[model samples]
Target: MLQRKLAALLILLPSSLSLTVTAQQQTPSNPVAPSQLALALPATASLSTEESHKPAFESSSAEGVIRITPAPQLEKELPSQRPFRTAAFGIKANTLGAGAELATPLFGRFNLRSGVNFLAFAYPFGIDGVNYNANLHFKSSQSTLDWFPGGHAFHISPGILYSKNTVSSAATVPAGQNFTLGDQSFINSVGDPVHGNMSLAYPRTLSPMLLLGFGNILPRNSRRLSVPMEFGVAYTGAATINVNLTGTACTNDGCTSFGGNSEVQASLTQEIHKINEDLKKVPVYPILSLGVAYHF
Candidate 1:
């Protein structure tokens, strides 16, 4: 039995040695020395350190490769904001317009406006006179001024006015009687007249006013509109004070005043003086008006 076992061992030992030598011949060479191997060992161990600092993605097909990006860092700062602005503009009677201010700037927030107001029946009136009973006329003029302020739409404007007021004075004096112009036989003081003369003359008046104002602001979507009325007194006259009233009714002749002899001549002379005195004394009257306006 011992001899047989020794024989089997010899055969297996030779086969094993041959297998070892063939494996050694098939293996590839190491290119590194002992010191190079030590250096290479550290480089291999440092792979974990490189991976910790890297972007954490790899081309290799690993078993469990997870990617995570930490929450973004947010800044802690205040936001930006802007402020509001004031407003400025002008308007006319019942519309937005530009006009000259006959009066100066008052109340800081107040402004005077002068423009044409083309509205029928806006200011209608009739007057009875000596020659004409009642003259009826339609007044539409080109000269008028308005004054007011932005707040509450309250304003006051006083300037020259050219309006026509007519009345009718047609009647018979009932066959010679002491009936004056006011007598019912001559001209009744009731309604307007039909066929009468209307004159475009200067009249003095104070215009206190109220209005509706509208406005718009672009940069900021803001709007303002209001209806405001105001009452005040004004005098329409010249800033300078100077009077000159003297004239004669000369028929196609180089005028000459025939002294204080002729009653007609004296009456006419005194009439002109009276007119001068009236113009000298300023008329302070109350005024009230209502209108609409727009602001932009």
Candidate 2:
């Protein structure tokens, strides 16, 4: 019985050994490394801790590739887009008179300006022994185109001046007092003073004007107020003088009608010619002004 049992045990041991050899042959000889394992797996199998916690705007593809896209940035503003101030109004004091003005922008570095001026006063003087009360009056309207060459406060202006200016006088001579008109000397008739009227005026009412100035009525920046100053001239042409007399006068001979006297008329014509000749020397009227203005 011992010999039989030994035989059966040897057969079963051989069969188990054969099965173990077969399983060992089917298995791999070397284990895979972590790096190799990762390459072997699908691309979406895993993600890094840092990549998993990224912001929504940043993203990673299923291929394990990172595609970071930056957010859009805001745009900046431009100077031309700023609000434009349209007009300005102001008061001024000038050689012509006290006045007010309006200014408006026309285009880049250009402006339009318009204003009016007025002044009236009296002066007393004596010419050729004639006591005269003279009234000087000034009224004018002007318009100009202002140009800023370097986009600065300094500007040049060309314009027109429409004037209603006059110099009028009342002439008188004391009764029996001597006076000269033209080249003739005469005496006022006793009980009758030599009374007359004289007027000086420009031949042209519209004159061309040119100006150079500092400061601007409408500033380009954020300022709301400015002080403007200007110096210029207007070509007004020669002035004309007229004289009329309505009183009695006496020459060496005798008293006669002052208005009807041929000698008196001739003298008056000569005097007028002389006055006009002097005026022709100065055909331009001066302009100077300073002002405060507000812009809107």
Candidate 3:
């Protein structure tokens, strides 16, 4: 009876009775084979593949974020100034403001220069102990030849200067000031100021000019830019000074008008004629200039 009971109990149980060990979140002793795991749990296999590549993806992302890259910088450029030329078309500036010239190499160490300078100015001066003021309206044209005897850096020039310079003034002498017009001493009526009109005419004829100069400001085969200086003189013709005199003056402390006297008037005319005689000694006009010029 015991044998039967044991057998019957055994039979009542399943034919293959074994405990199934399940680990949803634990690693197996031996890892699941790729083929078996794919068949058994496809999601598990896919999750394993994703986790295997996670470290590499993280490493790649880190490399992208933490990189030492040099920044690109930009630079700018500026234009350069040009130097002088050997033969050029140049513009020069001096006391005359502006003038244009053509500079060409003629014979060796020689250059021909021709240009004109003009200006209208008012100049006041004291000449031969006489105070004089005049408006200078002048135009001077030069036909000069430059000789670079001392190389290209220094030169001596000889030229013809045609000058059309004149002076005109409405002259007034202050009271108590004795002025010499022509060759006589004239005082404004002792207590009154005298007013008169005067004019001085200079020769417009061609005059001789001599100049000593330094530097070729225009670009040559050597230097590009330089400061040019020149000192010269022009032989101006005798000046003809004409004065129209009509004024009132007091004499002998009696306040008599001396301008109304025929004798005084005659004396004034004689004095006026003496101006040409007084200026007979001076006939040269000085020339000096510092200028900048550029070659083409």
Q: Highest TM-score: which candidate? A: 2
Q: Go through the candidates in order and give each one's C-alpha lDDT.
A: 0.35, 0.85, 0.63
TM-scores, all models, native as reference: 0.30, 0.69, 0.58
**Candidate 1 lDDT score at position 268:** 37
Candidate 1 off by > 4 Å: 1-114, 118-225, 232-235, 238-261, 271-280, 283-287
Q: What tens-digit string does per-residue lDDT give for candidate 1 at 1-296?
A: 99999999998999999999998899856556777776666443646555666674542122333566677899642111021123223233422112221222223334443444333332333322223233334332222233334433333344443333322334322222221212121222122221222232225333333333232111122343433333444343421221121222222232333232254345434544454466456544333433333333
Better of 1 and 2 by TM-score: 2
Model 3 regions lying over 4 Å from their true place: 1-100, 125-132, 175-193, 218-220, 253-262
Candidate 2: residue 47 lDDT (0-100): 60
How many clashes show up per model? 12, 0, 4
Worst window of 10 by summed lDDT in candidate 2? 76-85
Better of 1 and 2 by lDDT: 2
TM-score computed on alpha carbons, candidate 3: 0.58
Better of 2 and 3 by lDDT: 2
Per-prediction CA RMSD (Å): 16.0, 9.8, 16.0
